[model samples]
Target: MGGAMKIVLIDSNARAVSSEDREVSVGSLTRLLGSKPAVTARLPNGDRLLTAKEPCVDNGFTIGRSRVVVGAGVVVGKRDAVGAYTPPKTNVDTLTKLVRWVAPDNMPRESEDGRTMVTAILVDPETRDIRQVSLRSDAGSLDGAVGGRCRFMMRVTTADAVFVKVGIGPRAAWRKDGLVFPGRSLIVGCSRYGTLVDVATDIASLRASVEFKSPDAPDWLPPSR
Candidate 1:
């Protein structure tokens, strides 16, 4: 069974203009709000705060003591939908589980006493989830491949890594590898010795790139193109 649903149209000052009980559905809410609604917040009590997906300053309203500007915002309960309440679809935080690395068979080998290190930056094209992973090879072996996972699924459009170090101690040095895999989707594999490999995938692609930032350079210096 579905829970009772309520819709309230508020102004920029957070005052409710009209409040009523209604069956929750995208179409019904869109028609009432005069625009597509976006879930802005998930309340502690399982209620959701929804507002126009795009800014609607003309019909803006403020809510709470914080005065959040929720233009045409609507509040609904968890089970307010026609059937069961289904949360809004979001790429953010989706598939956030750890992804294992697909190491190459011919990964570079290091000396028995030496250690290999690699730093990889991975981004999900769809969610724009950026993650940094550090991998270290066991002493004397080239099998230091680690997986990558997103700590925070941000809406960042771009990411850059300057001064990437790959290799064993003393032998570890910076490399200039700027690569972008746009449009095409691919999985990433990193060798213990800091080599990056790409495998094409059908659904989504990852972007990998590296730039050298001199140790002596000032912190404020922008990365070289």
Candidate 2:
């Protein structure tokens, strides 16, 4: 069922007298997110919701938690609606960290050859600094060409996020060359704090573009247009 409680609102200052707290609604959630709110919140459940009428999706990533679109903003939790003062489940703030913790076991394996695997995750945000990534294990042979078909035997080389259509299951395995994410990659792995798209799924996919960060980049993703 849909959640209740409208957090977003429209504004007006038509009269001379002041008033008490009133509810407001907005037409679009996208505009609200674009406004770049100062505060973002998460409820008791696993969703990463906001109070000031903002949508959640950004860049090529979605907040791992489920979201309920309220009046203008979104509420992240299990139930559709809850009390206004919903507390968080953990002390670990930040949406990315929340998602990484939300899914403790989302590491993915391929379906084709079933031999390749994803081992690490890293991020390079447009404005944020590139935090050093700690590899949990050795990801063997992430890219190559077999039978003239380019793919990762198992490797991730670039920092650009490879977008995918389906969410991966933890410790899940797929056949080799089976991951077909849109932009030059096909691997996804989960970290202690979140999931990551293996942008360097193969050699050819990375070689397909030249307009990005490095000459050796399998794909190119400038911070922003």
Candidate 3:
């Protein structure tokens, strides 16, 4: 029906190992390579699938002059025949993008406990004051944090108008923990606001004045007779 799909196998040093141009599908490619292929990178025309016998290795191939040490032998070909392709917009990837958007000058760091933290420099649009705050979240990896937290922080520091509400309920009245709201709440709340700027700024003036109180504080407790 169409031109036969072609695949090129390259070694760790970007040397061409072999080429196969025939009736190629993901199943056939897997049988030929003897392992499930993992897409290590995406090119303009196709994707690079890791086909090395030892997928985990120090040495790797180069895409132009840049060395990509993610895997050993890699199969380069069109992704049409590959199995369900996962877009690069995974939670971790999104988190990374948002982190960069909110904190262009700082890089995200990973803690030993596997949380990602980024320092966002917020600028007040009114008085032009600047404040730096650490945003942390867990996305199950060291590469980035969850998108939810980053998105919340993004709105808090960027939105021209942001509204925040705090409420408390009896532990027995709530299905989940009543002491604190789930982190997802922030994500849902911020979803209503669209991104307006990249750099973090306290345009709302609330960031610099907000205070956190312990749950044990008398005012936080419900009034009793």
lDDT (CA) per prediction: 0.37, 0.30, 0.34
Using lDDT as the yardstick, the better of models 1 and 2 is 1
Q: Indicate the residue-level lDDT of 13 in model 1.
A: 31
Q: Top TM-score: which candidate number?
A: 1
- Residue range 1-225, candidate 1, lDDT tens digits: 233454544433333344566656777777656678777766555666677676544433223311233355665556544555634322212211211222234232333544333344433332334455443322211122212211221212222212221322332112223343331111233322223322222112222232223334433222232
Candidate 1 regions off by >4 Å? Answer: 1-5, 11-17, 65-67, 80-83, 86-225
Candidates, ranked, lDDT: 1, 3, 2
Question: Tens-digit lDDT track for model 3 on 111-131?
Answer: 576444434333222222334
| TM-score for all models, in order of appearance | 0.30, 0.24, 0.27
Judge candidate 1 at residue 5 and give its lDDT: 53
lDDT of each residue in 21-95, candidate 2, tens digit only: 222223233444444332354455564444333334321112443221222234433333543323333333343
Q: List the candidates ranked by TM-score, beginning with the highest.
A: 1, 3, 2
Which ranges of candidate 2 are over 4 A from the true structure?
Answer: 1-24, 28-31, 34-60, 65-73, 76-96, 99-225
Model 3 shows how many backbone clashes? 1
For residue 79, model 3's alpha carbon misses the true position, in angstroms, by 4.4
